[model samples]
Target: MDIVFDTQQEAADFYRRMPSSFRQVTGVMLINSRLAVFPQKTADYREFAQLITRYIIEKYEKKWIMFIIEKYYYFTDAEEKVTILNIVAAIFSGEKDDLPHTGTLQDRHETIMASLEGVLKEHNTFSFQSIIRFRLTAYREVLRQYVEIAIDEYKLEQEYQVFVDKLRRIVHAYKPLCEKIEVYDEHPFKLFDEHHRLIRNVQSVRSFYPLLKQWGIEAEPSIILSLIALAPKQVIVYTDRPEHGMMKTLHRVFEERVCFARRTLHLGNGSDYSG
Candidate 1:
């Protein structure tokens, strides 16, 4: 089904509200097609809309034939539109084995041209190239936008991979290098700072930043690995989140050297450390 936008503002508004997923490609195509009546627009939006529409049509030709048919009706001459509809119906009406090979764009295009030629022979007036010329001229901008989106998605994926690799390295760095040894701590420190007490209302990574600063650690993995390397005979963790990832990593690295703190220190409330 097609979503008709009667005004440029309506189409722009719809596009803004659309989700940035594959599903939005259809809306983009519909909006761009409806806005085809407007002129002097940049190529980016047109390229994006047409590229997605072409890809979807290629991948699921049968599923999208009706949609394409509807879109064409709005822009094509009556004779050309009739020829396209007849060609589509004739190609899909036959047995599945008679369908053209769609292994590649060339194959699909050749299949479509062959069908078009066969149908056009009856009228002796329409050519596949003529219809394509109109489409290419009308949707040239869409092709440019398609290229831009592809590049953007590629860059985003690379960034995601880099972040994931960083995390993996941190995990691997803390893994035991040799047989486990008992740690001896000369200075036992908790995750709390000298200025703040544990507030039950807060729950976020930022909440621990001040505490980490007080503990003289810059990174989460740094503190955990540092505590292990310090070889604390007993490292006391005064945290309610005993099952936290950092605590678990510590236990895995230090084995029996890590211990849970039995007392709570309210450094934020001006409480004195008895240790």
Candidate 2:
């Protein structure tokens, strides 16, 4: 029989004990699962949000069912995406377990958080693990800042500690799955486009993660795109002012040059992203 939980700890415990065949952890339902079984240390919100978003969307959203957990919901249908993500703000800033999903601005904030959670995970992983690194050189500082702030806002200190401890116990725990994205003296993941793209976008390989996420990448990889940086392709980021036309001839360039850096940069090369 299908079950619904109004609490994280309760669901976590149940999901942990249940067989994977019939039951699974849905969205933020990790309180008593393996997390409950183990002790926590660094619940960094950056990591926490990312993991929660990924887990929910990857497992439930694709199923085309709106699995709403207490306040958190996972459904990819464009119309419902924003409404569900908003549920996090209630969870984040201390709202009731069953938040009112009205079309209010408060709900809007929560919705944005959920969307950010999904986008941030893709961006961070791409920045840290992509095959191409040099292309990301320019955005490294911004990306790091993002991680710091998101973690802080998410109240993720406990999560971060837990990740560190778990990573230590496992093989290649901190080892990234992408490629050179993290090596750029920074990261590759960024809030790249104001709008999605096609040809010109791919020309500059550095911004692949943001672009991929915008494009709603089909491979749906939790992979490190590259470990070794490759030569970056140039593209212009248009401006909105009068002098700089919407299509100004602004050429975006990489801070450095990389070469045949690493192969199998992403995790989906049929290999494990963690490995």
Judging by TM-score against the true structure, name the best candidate.
1
Runs of candidate 1 exceeding 4 Å displacement: 1-56, 59-124, 175-275
**On a 0 to 1 TM-score scale, where does candidate 1 land against the true structure?**
0.25
lDDT of model 2 at position 66: 28
What is the lDDT for 14 in model 2?
A: 46
Q: What are the per-residue Cα lDDT tens digits for candidate 1 across 1-275?
A: 23334456645554454445533443334344242222123343343344434443454454334335445334245554444444444433432223334121133333333333333324323322343434333233332232233334434545644644443344345443223222222134333322332222223334545644544445544455444333334555666666866667666655555676534544334333221
* TM-score for each of the candidates: 0.25, 0.16
Winner by lDDT: 1
